[model samples]
Target: MHPSFTQRVTALEGLRARTRQATAEFYQKPGVMPPPLAPLIIVRSSGNNTFSLINRATGEVIAERFGHNNATSHARELEADIKRFNVKQFGRHLRDWALRISAILFLFAFFGSHA
Candidate 1:
């Protein structure tokens, strides 16, 4: 049998607490610094077929929308947010890939022309 919504939420909260404790301990070692914690989002469906976007770190309801369609849309929005955050975090390295590819193509073209 499927667990009820409250049970699932409780489990998730427990897991989050444990993870936070572990992270704190790991960073307490000498010469180690802790970075900002990432936002952990959870999507859950209720018995009534409604969906919620929850922030596991703060146990906040990011959003609560009804129906499967709205849930899917919200999921997509969350995905976009993650992508945006990744771009902001590692965008410079990603942009370097374009330059590297261009350099490789230029070398290929130049070498092929001489052949």
Candidate 2:
């Protein structure tokens, strides 16, 4: 293999590592995109009057089409299960996204960068 190709592969691998690290940090660190809230914690959504109940791990919507009391109450009722789902779903999505991105990068490096 050519030296330039080898160098390009190394650089792409480094980029892949950094991207994976960033995604992991975004999911693990508190108060990033989705503020880490305890299960069923009452919170208000920005740009709207309706309250929001979210799975802190995935930033997914638990309930929003209901009133504050009902939404929060329902969220509390399902908190445990939702947390489990959120954790699993977060891992699944993270893995999928990372793998897809890595594969795309690999193809681009191996084929598109050929000279």
Instruction: Indicate the residue-level lDDT of 67 in model 2.
Output: 65
Best by TM-score: 1
Cα TM-score per model: 0.35, 0.30
List the candidate 2 regions with Cα displacement exceeding 4 Å: 1-37, 40-42, 46-49, 82-115
How far does residue 13 in candidate 1 sit from its true spot (Å)?
A: 23
Which digits, one per residue and each the tens of the lDDT, describe model 1 over residues 1-115? 4579889999999999999999989999999977855546677786497888787777777888888788768866885777675756688887899899999999999999999
Against the reference, the lDDT scores of all candidates come to 0.81, 0.74
At residue 79, candidate 1 shows an lDDT of 58
Q: Which residue pairs collide, candidate 1?
A: none
Candidate 2: lDDT of 76?
Answer: 71
